[model samples]
Target: MPVSQQRPLTFFGVAFAFLATMLGTTLPTPLYPLYQTQFGFSQLIITVIFAAYAVGVIAALLVTGRWSDQLGRRPILLGGLFAAMISDAVFLQADGLGAMLAGRVLSGLSAGVFTGTATVAVMELAPSYLKRHAALAATAANMGGLGLGPVVAGLCSRYLPDPLWLPYLLHLGLAGLAMLAIWQAPETVTRPERIRLRLQRLSVPTEVRAVFVPAAIAGFAGFSVLGFFTATAPAFMGRIMDVSNLLAIGVVAGLPFFASTVGQLAQERVPLSYRLPLGCVILLLGVVAIGAGIALASLTWFVCGAVVAGIGQGIAFRAGLGEVVAASPLTRRAEVTSSFFVVAYVAISLPVVGIGVTARLIGLQATGEIFAALVALLVLMALVLLRRQRRPVMP
Candidate 1:
């Protein structure tokens, strides 16, 4: 169990596999506009479709949250990859909304299985000397990969021959490669274990509550940033800004995620105590920019806001996660992480749907300003709470 003796290659393999899985979940980000055109759906419908994916994620977290820790990381990951492959196939044959929804549902399940399982696998495989780096790797791989997906898809959609088919086809290839990688990677868990399958409710230990509250709040705020881009940014860019280009839409929509990736990279340098509050304040600035973008109807302004806000989200999120993981027992780290994800996904799902409703009633521009302001308020409240906790206690 020496720190130096752990196999770095196997550790990397686990990280890469998880990264691929997360990428697969977001691969469809740019394709939503195409789907909307093909299916003739409205903004509300699109949100519903995106929310369906979140629902699948929550369902998997509740059901299999603890299964991977007990059953072994390889099995859970392989299972997740299998589901992702199925999801790609579903999209490939997608002829209507039903097929697309099914594909999204499967995609969500794949993420649910992979997220917790892969994080544990990476840590289990890491060299003891690199244990702290292992945590950064987990957050970076997950968030960074998710950010990369839409960008990749956007490039392919614009430059490549086939937009829809090519992206999914590329994903299918990546997923296959990941499968091979996983098969060859080392298994972290010992055998002779019981596997239980049933609905499980989300829970947190009292010891973890302090870290959990701030972490979950940060997750909520960060993922809401993601939701704005993934769920609605494309539509806004194309329809409102008059930029109907696929690549532009994808890049603008993907800005926050990529910025977040950068933020996570910076987490090791910034102490956790400062990361949360500072991130919140920076996020507020990004929100302000987004609101201004909507008010001014400027594409450049909106994209700029996404980039700035994305960085704050990334910093806060990684710091929050680090705090929670530090306090969680290794035995149930994956479960705790899954709980964190469940909160994040809720933030991703509901608020974006609300925006969709607003877009329908008020207008896309107005809705954008409204959502930015609301999320800004939420981040402000979280900042106040986190600062209060950081204050000294009276004797």
Candidate 2:
């Protein structure tokens, strides 16, 4: 197909593949409560299980982060999809806590590989006539895929006869289809022979340093919001509020990502100077609502807070990412981007683990209040920094 003709299919393929990878990541969201009951684990262990996936993601980003740029997008994506398939298999056969952890680890590995590579592929595959659409493809595939994951898994778990088995089974089918689509897609890398296997050290170079510090901190704060949903929110819903509906849980978990998508969509209208600061202010509102929900033990407050905070996370996260990507030199784009991801994943992992600790010591509700306060303070700091600096004129 001509480049111009490839837009629709490229968007579909990239979006489909992106969602498949994220579905593998969140496939276990609604199931965490089930695992707690089945394996008789503590809440801390649930947080630990989620953290294990973050470990896999960070590890993969550090070691093979730029492999796609070298070896070509197709092989890396194919491997990612295949890894997701194995992860689904692990979930399907999970009988113990170890198997569940193993499945999550593999799922994270799949996501780690796919996130960066598939993003570039989507951009590269855009039709010549629709070249400008690549940005939308990349952003939508990312945030949209994340939002779709829990929704898809949640629906399957609620309606399907065997909740655990059926969700993975459905995901397994989706992964297989994604794999087929990827395999048949055109190879964008021209001189495949020049590519070589190499390990990447995740580092922020001198050139990226000036912009890297604030950008990374902003990313950390934004991703911490995601950490709340992916790791702690569902447990909060069930344990504190006594709500146990799988679909409802999924919706709550998905709200931030959906809001993030909205943030990205609204990016064009919002000035860069305003995006981060305004996003932080909105994020603070979310933290407040979440804290309120926990204190009052009200599900309504929790859901509302999630939507508001999610919009903030979406706005600030994209702006921070855009600044970093735009600032980095072309040759170092992938490495720098991977470093940003490393920072973001760490934000997601470490904070949630800390919350688990606080929940154990103080109480889940109390810990939630503390977490919200800390995040709110962080956003305030980001805003302070934004105000101190002069705005750069956009090209």
Each candidate structure's TM-score, on Cα atoms with residue i matched to residue i, is: 0.91, 0.93
lDDT of 1 by residue, 6-100 (tens): 47877887788888888888888888888888889898888888888898889888888777656778888999999999999998988988988
lDDT of 1 at 258: 79
- Which one is best on TM-score? 2
- Give the per-residue lDDT digits (tens) of candidate 2, residues 1-395: 77556556855786688877886787677778888888897888889888888888887777767788677889889988888899899988888879878987888888888777888888787777657877777777777767777777778778878887888888888888898778767888865666677777667779778677766777787789898898887789998999898888887888888888887777668977677777778888888888898899999999888888888888877888888888888878777888888999999889998988888898998888888888877877777667665466679
Residue 294 deviation, candidate 1, in Å? 1.8
Query: Model 1, poorest ten-residue lDDT window?
Result: 192-201
Clash-forming residue pairs, model 1: 3-128
